[model samples]
Target: MPEDLPIGRRERLLAALRSRGSVRVRELAAELGVSLPTVRRDLALLADRGLISREHGGASARTSAPERRTDGPRWVVGMVLPSLHYYFPTVAQGVKAVADAAGAKIVLRGSDYDPVVDREQIGLLVARSEIDGLIVAPELRHPQAPEMLRWLDALPLPVVLVERQPPSDFFIEQLQWVASDHRRGGETAVEHLLAQGHRRVGIFGTDNVTGMQVADGWRQALRRHGIDPDEQLMGRTGLFQRDARISAFGDVVERVRKGTLTALIVQPDPDAIALAQRCLEAGLRIPEDLAIVAYDDEIASMGDPALTAIRPAKAQVGRLAMEVLLHRLRLGHDAAPQQLLVRPQLIPRQSSLG
Candidate 1:
């Protein structure tokens, strides 16, 4: 923490910077529960103390801000992501590693899955005069996503999206991103189950971008085997409704017992692990009664039988995102934007193979 500064705001600000790498002034204002001017004053003091580096729109950890190179002006980058939890921490770690190596300053902020927050954070970064480029994982679930895309396209700085892939029908040229190809992840699960001679496979997961892509791949893989994909076999639900989730879990267990469903692919670790527990309660033998392949390898092995799962290269995505942004910073904005996808690896455990 910065020495001799006010306890609450300075400590919190430093903590945010360490977790986020960088931050916008408005974001800090909101986080500190202080007014904009107060935040600006605190930032100025911190900068003077050499506790932080004041950049274009916000302040960053002093170490993360690019040093005076004598070769050129300092390069500042703005990054906004959805959340700091779950799948994104590794992503941020990767981004920080690359940025530190390149001697570029990175200002990072979290949008908390709110579309309004996304706009506000990005606007703050863009408002800064020194921000050379941007890396964003926007809230694509918003109703006005297209308008947001247009706005991002109009920004002067080069922009690279981390984990977000806008629909191809939307202007891919306007907003290029690097993301995990979750659709292919789903296909890999189905192919593995098919190879094991499981004919009736089901899918279960929350209704979200990743889940939708995995389902698309699951259906396509089934078609390649000359079988019509069963919509009835697809389960859509979220964790918010506990009774509903459990009821659906019971239904899936019944299906397995009756030999109507021979295997299942479930996305995200929590839901898959929950389903495994439910199956055990229903006296179903894993792989013997039914096999399971889970998407998102996080904690998948914690299940009683351990789960076969798809592991996305999350840190690599972060590393590649910064690399892509660095490439854009060197080349002018006139250069073509790059869109890339990283494939997830399918990990086998006792849940599916045993």
Candidate 2:
């Protein structure tokens, strides 16, 4: 058998230890075709389990059956998100699919885009003591975000951040997160618009972390293409704040009429649809006078003239977050923290064709 195979490493090590009474680390590394560090780590794990006695440079098998405590209790994961309806149900469904396959149960809770509520929901789950791990999508741009991160970092159980990430300056060694590449999604939208001969572009985003990332991508893309970015063309409003959009409509129309704003990349499909409606009412033809690209793909296709959109791999983020948390639970302290960023795809439609 090939020595490099990992499937039977532990069994082979135990057999060698039993037959020889002791196995040198160098000999074990050579026999297993693994590094000395790998052998040492295995030995340490085995020693902790009472499976072997560690010597200066080797290990010896125990005469009695080893008291193994490597296996962990079955996992029950808690999931908390800011919304149950928009942009999160599909993610939740993906998490549920993985949990079901692993024979694990999920305790789910919803928050109303408030960091305080998010903390409360998480506290409720942690108080139960049955939850082995957690998957959370908290409002990371809120005023209490720093405090929340500190609290989450000190939790007893493992946590996997979903959709949201820590602030750029904050660093935690054991923090794990999985998020969509929203910044790249923004850049892609701008590049597509530039490809379509849009020299002057604008971005309408929400006042949230995802929106900020998209805007950052947009700014970076513009700089890369040597286009002078205009601050007047960039606008950010609160989520679900229709009055803010209404108040900005006049300025937007004036800019469109003056030929300063040729295209726009709007975050969230519903907001894009609303902007498109307003543009149409103002006598601007879609893809003719005003081209629009939406950030979220949800409901973008259903809009009039069908909007071009950046489709983030939301389901994959959820699935990977759950998988990472479960793997950490199984490995205990052996597993390393992981930060995964999945790319987003741009779907071109009639909205940006012109």
Candidate 3:
């Protein structure tokens, strides 16, 4: 074998300092196969970075301390979101901006909107001691149930809920959560259509909590307007499926052709865009043939006929979640749980009106 190359001096010095609180310059120099002056220089640089403190003769390890009421952790912030789709990426960017200012690193994972995957990712994060805090977009309807809450309950650091809420009552009291008022968003969309004189409006969504809330908003709004909601106009797509989206849109188009639906409220921009396409292909003119208002305002920029949509304040949600999480980190355990409701705005386009 070739002669064993010397170990990096920085690695050797770090290992020595970790085992013992303090290490002499000569000892690190000898162990690292470097000169005494070089070892001292390395320790001085480490001290400058606040990684360690140097005494008259050597350097000492840092003691583990809880975050102060005004100062956040000097480590990592774990962030778990549902997906990189329509809105979550914007949330990630917002978190990144806050993390940059706070000098904390962010670790990201996606649930793909699946509870099982979310659980697995959460378990992996909780197992790591390097993670200082957790910011999660939890699935409201999860099959794992108690095990999931048990996992969250066991974490030592502050757990902040972002965007979506879990079903557990304990988390409701223990966690700081920030989300768009999706129920109000649903109500706003339906109420807009109703105000414009559309009585038999269709509501389409997934079976997820956010979806259910949006769907329920439509029903409640219709009830408020003295219109009996049509169950036939209600439809669900699988959590994340392109084919399910196509089928769902097709079903809605068939209903529209039969004169059952005069307006529609669909969640997220993906399904709304798909629905718009199917309606156009079926020889239906928007607003004249059928009116649509999507949950996310993304589609208004895409096509010739822009989709009228209810735009969730994604950037604001992301900014507020980070702000609350950072506040919790600085204030520690005594800080009260915070709940923020950011409003969603309605953007009207050609798809919903003349």
- Each model's lDDT comes to 0.78, 0.81, 0.72
Tens digit per residue, CA lDDT, model 3, 262-331:
8988776777777777677778888887888888776655844788889888888888888887777777
Give candidate 1 regions above 4 Å deviation: 1-74, 237-246
Model 1 lDDT-worst window of ten: 62-71
lDDT score for residue 90 of model 1: 86
Q: Which candidate is the best by lDDT?
A: 2
lDDT, candidate 2, equals 0.81
Winner on lDDT between 1 and 3 is: 1
The model with the greatest TM-score is 1
Per-residue lDDT for 1-354 in model 2, tens only?
A: 222224257656766876687999999999999999999888786665444689999998654321223354256788999989988888888898888887777899999788878977887675453566789998877678887886676554578999988877996756689999888998999999999999889988987778889998999999999987764388865322356634677777888899998899988898888888878877989998889999879899998989999998888888898999877877764788888999899999999997
What is the C-alpha lDDT profile of model 1 across 1-354, one tens digit per residue? 223446445556766775576899998888778898888887786676445678988987643222345654356788998878878888888988888898877888998888899988886675564676789998887789987776676553567888888777886444568898888988899999998888898888767677888999898999988867864378774431356534676677668767889898887888788777777777888879989898888899998889999898999999999888887766654456789999989898998884
Task: Return the candidate ranking by lDDT, descending.
Answer: 2, 1, 3
Model 2 vs truth, CA RMSD: 12.5
The local lDDT score (0 to 100) that residue 190 gets in candidate 3 is 86
| TM-score, predicted candidate 1 vs. hidden true structure | 0.76
lDDT of 3: 0.72
Which candidate do you rate higher for TM-score, 1 or 2? 1
